[model samples]
Target: MDEFLKWYFSHNPVAAASLGAEGYDHTLGDLTASGWQTREREQVQWLDRLSAAEAPSLDDAIDRDLVLSQLRGSIALASWPEWRRDPAVYLSTIFAAMYTPFQRRLKPEAELVESALSRLAEVPGVLAACRANLDPDLAAPLLVTRGLGQARTGRNLLTRTIPAMVEDAELRARLAEAAEPAARAFDDLVAFLEGFECGGTWRMGEKLYSTLLREREMLGYGAAELHAKGQAAWSELDARMRAVAVGVNGGDDWRAAMESLMDDHPPTLADMRAEYEAETRRAREFVRERDLVTFADGEECEVLPSAEYTRPVLAVAHYLAPPPLSASRRGIFFVPYTPDDFTPEQVRQRLRTNSRAQMPSIAVHEAYPGHHWHLSYMAGNPRTVRKVFRTPYFTEGWALYVEKLLHEQGYFDTPATELAHLDCRIFRAARIVVDTALHCEDMTVEEAETFMSTKASLSPGTAQGEVSRYCAWPTQAPSYLTGAIEIDRIRESFQGTPKEFHDRIAGSGGLPLGLAEQVALA
Candidate 1:
């Protein structure tokens, strides 16, 4: 296990350092086409080596499965056209490597500065590799647009955020020197993309989408089954939302009520951050008071603003889990606050995003009993494979499960709060509908965006942003609800307390819902 784990981390040096692997802090990952081929070949070799090894216990058995799943997924991803056509994979990786070390506080400032600069210096070559690899015929228009936005933000991250973090004059000077070249690389990518006619659609079609869900996600269901499930969930949540809206405003129009409630937002960004912080603290207290879940000793989560480059995909809130092997146990819950450069209309949309009525559920999802809580527990485990091989189903499903759990525990404060929670359910439900529709059905990106805006009650921009993410990554968008549904079924038949069930699942260290269900029920 250790031998294969070592190879996995070493193949992606930037991810290694980001994940708290020692001695990889000075290197950036290889983004070239040949580099990807090498990694895929290495993954196949390791998969064979791991398959021949014996597992003496259930835990060991699970670990072996993890290794197999990870290698298979890595290889599958390498085969996908997304890596070459979607610039986010390269651009985000570059910005993430630059900022993640600082965020983790894994090394001293001086050491981190040196490491960041080293990675930053490699940015030009990485971008050039992306330019060479991308096929204009295969590129999706929405992705190209989204990639351009991310590329621009990458330049800002290098020029502004990264330099300000380093106090050493020489390192700062080096950073300044590298900034332009990095910026130019992003510009070159944008220019290259602009030369193409961006009329291409973003759908992956049903066959590839089904294959990804079955193979990579280890899901038993097909796209049609999942689509049916999503449609059912949307119907139920829509009914619940309308009931709340009728109570709130004597009308059945939930979208209007949701919009009105969205207007009730924090007056300032500082106030918004304060609200998020307060909710996290409140959630911790609630968990302690009710004994709803357990966390490891000395575990905590910090609420912070999302990094500028991350704000677009992570429009509302995102939990940055502590690296599995890292010394720090604190997860950063990033609230995507409106940046200072935003226009009035953008600010309004952002304010609507973090409205007071809806924040508690988002806070709960990102912090207590959600990502931060799940990750904090996993961090305490000594198993390296457990840390490295998490399923989005378990992590995301557990969070979504907790949202429903909170509702059952009467966690919502008012009708609006219940409305907000139901609204979230609606959002996830819509993700299922549109995620499959965009990728598997005939739904165009524009059609998906409109559907999301109308059904999920998101603004056009927010809806476009959400749909854009689903386009880049197929099958992942549906995990929040699908994973939760799996857990909910298990929970209904279990004889244990909520805490027991939760601890049992979290103790499994982020397994697939099928494996986790068997473990819990056994």
Candidate 2:
């Protein structure tokens, strides 16, 4: 079952790239109409088989808890969006994963470029299939994301940053050629959306949205439940942030303290890199002190500038996977580095935006206790499905949970650090409201941006981008909070238990929520 699950997920181009699976490297040739039809047909049939053959009693017999959840999630992923080309459901393929290939020499960039170029031709076919196969007249909520498949596919082409991933002169030449067609394919997709789909989009509808909530909630938490908690969490965080908002009179305020530590906000790119390295070192020390999450003794991380081209879309800071599983045990926290000469103010802000007091707390979210630690832990876990199955809510939730854990255990005790924690809380709290607001409520993108900038103290640019991301990805924002809250609930549920959180579940930690429940609640 483990090997089979790996086969299944490895076939998914999204997981393949993000997980760095070797065999399924070519996503382009596979995205065709016949190709999609075959896969979809196979998936539908597979679900029917599983739903009919089993009574879901396997969870009782499945010794590994993570495997149990994978078996369960497999059933959900099989039905998945009901349309292979539905961009809204499938955009996670583009935006959330697949960065390492574009930014680092994780693998041969030419292969990546070729794979992306091939995918360009298949986008239109998939979109057409969505129109042809999915009920066109259906409508209720967010567009099902048809008609924009090609454009969405194009979003990942990323020619501008190809140079960062590869330095070979010949490869550079190939990249120059690849970038144009790749960008053009996606640009065309965007143009098509502007003209055709934006106004009269085919909505996957509320029913599907509800289903999405179910599939995720089963792994994370329920939607209405998440929505309510998100609201409550925001209110709680706002109060905390306001409490910490000591007005800055030069050096006195928490915000000013953050600024001073960031080298008066790094007037130069070199300064920003220095700050990032300093922060990365700070993270290493923090983890070492607490033994928070398992950090391999030999694991070393550095903070480097994000390639100028990729920085905008990346988290203010991100983890680059260790090269190809063979090169190193370490991952670099790729901090965004805008050229000081290119955009001084923007560079400074980009540099300062993430590492500032609040941002390092996010480091716990994205780096140590977050994606990196989880990825490393899960990737190495013995369970087969563990490597393939990614429950974003559970993983994101754990990281978010740990940010507060740091404070709870005295990781962030300084007034400045505490305020940073508050800011992180504020932003996440804002996420709870804004995620639902963009997807389910009447607010415009501008409204969402304003809410974050003013309330969370985000820059206007950051706010706008975040709102766009929230809009493009439905129900995801709430997950960080929802997952965090769920982890908290799980912890409280087992509060006085003698078993360690890691011990009861033991090595089954890589598995997501469904598995967590068995051990956590036991």
Candidate 3:
């Protein structure tokens, strides 16, 4: 059963084609295709069968708890296809998500080009659905254009790349065959984008925005709620952050204090690596010392570089969680080096270029006692179902929470590092504001970008890209803050109860949040 789940989840055509899976994307492009539909139906059937079999086999309460957690997760994916959007949007999203990760390990002979080109030809049909579902309104075209831009993203990555790489002859030959098909797809995508007319006068009506909000809240919560809580938490956290800097900055204004403290003890890229290593060692101690976690000896990870294209869009550092089934796939952390043409001091000040303030905090969030630790446990959990239905909100929330946990445990004793911690919180708060103001509030693209830049101190391009993402996809970003806070609240609620949130949630077998239906649902 575990083998089945692993095989199903890991064979993502998006990942496969992007990495050179020939015809893989084409085979899966028609999500309603017979084979795809059959496999989905069978997956649902297997859950029922597994539930009966796994339930009786549990020998103890803990074993039962683990099994149920996994089961709930599996059921969620099998049931919740509504989260999936139209083809152009989905493909572009696939391209965006995959572009950065694969550039680092992409091969010339890979089948990705073959699969992507074949699927590229299918973009027209996918857009047809968007047109049908959204027409009778002018805003439909803008939405359609946004959808098409996404597919073009994948088409562009494949068309502009793969051929010139001096790596794989066979792949190059295969990629050549895909050239025409890829070009055609690119044209279709461009035509869609060209027809877009929403321009500056565009506004997603309040009712439309509300509909988006409801569907979004289905995955997570509202921004106004998160924003209110974040403002309050920000004040509470600012005090703690300042205290962490008291030795050097005299416990004054945290932002100023951080700058004063960081003015000294500057670290190079190499120093950042060393800091990361030291923190990894301490993370292991934090887990074992407090008996807070159980880490696998078999599971370990190494930090690597962010793929060039996608690296620009993400934080300076990010973690790649391993598949639950692949024992060999270690959890990975990528710390990127900035492209040349900038001064070293300026680079270090940029979060993407600086590893000094980022490496430790990132490792805490992305690796040890963070995403890797939790995910590996989820993977290894006896409840195979819980392992499959991962919620980004739940997973990211836990990771961000663990980051704060480790910092407070005295891992970040320095004022400079402590300031970085608050900066992270600020980043999430900004996400709350950006995500809500753009989608529900219907702020223009430029207005949303300014909100992040002026308040969060984010770069314009970074802010704009993030706003585009929030507008296109609602409620997903706020999960970083909303999900984390929910975890904290649940943990607090459970403090006096017989079972902890950790235990209750884990015991519930990591069921998809959707399946609870609601605590009082009749």
Q: Give per-model TM-scores.
A: 0.95, 0.75, 0.66
lDDT of 1 by residue, 225-322 (tens): 89999999999988888888987678989999989999999887778888999999988788788998887777779888888887656566888888
Q: How accurate is candidate 1 locally (lDDT)?
A: 0.81
Q: Candidate 3: misplaced stretches above 4 Å? A: 1-26, 31-88, 93-156, 159-168, 199-224, 239-251, 257-291, 308-316, 336-355, 442-451, 454-457, 492-522
Report the Cα lDDT for residue 361, model 2. Answer: 79
TM-score of 1: 0.95
Q: Pick the candidate with the highest lDDT.
A: 1
lDDT of 2 by residue, 354-466 (tens): 54555567667666655665555544554444455556667667777778777887767666667777777767778877776565554676788888876665667667667
Model 2 global lDDT (CA atoms, 0 to 1): 0.55
Q: Tell me the whole-model lDDT of each prediction, alpha carbons only.
A: 0.81, 0.55, 0.53
Pairs of residues at least 3 apart in sequence or in different chains that clash in candidate 1: none
Clashing pairs in 2: 144-203, 144-204, 217-221
Task: Name the candidate, 1 or 3, with the larger TM-score value.
Answer: 1
Q: Please tell me which model should have the higher TM-score, number 1 or number 2.
A: 1
Q: Which lDDT tens digits does candidate 3 get at residues 1-522? A: 555544454445554443322334454344334434466666566556655654344323233333344444434433323213233444444453334323434333354455445554554454444333332333434345455544454444555554554256766666655655655655665675566444231333344433333342343434455556656665666566657556556765555554544444325555555566566666767666866665665777666555444433443566666555344336667664443433665455554324355456667787777777777666665554554455566677777877777776777666666667666776677677666666555466778788766545355555665666565555556667666666665565344332234434533333334332221121
**RMSD (Å) per prediction:** 1.9, 5.5, 7.3
Backbone collision tally, model 1? 0
Error of 1 at 285 (Å): 0.8
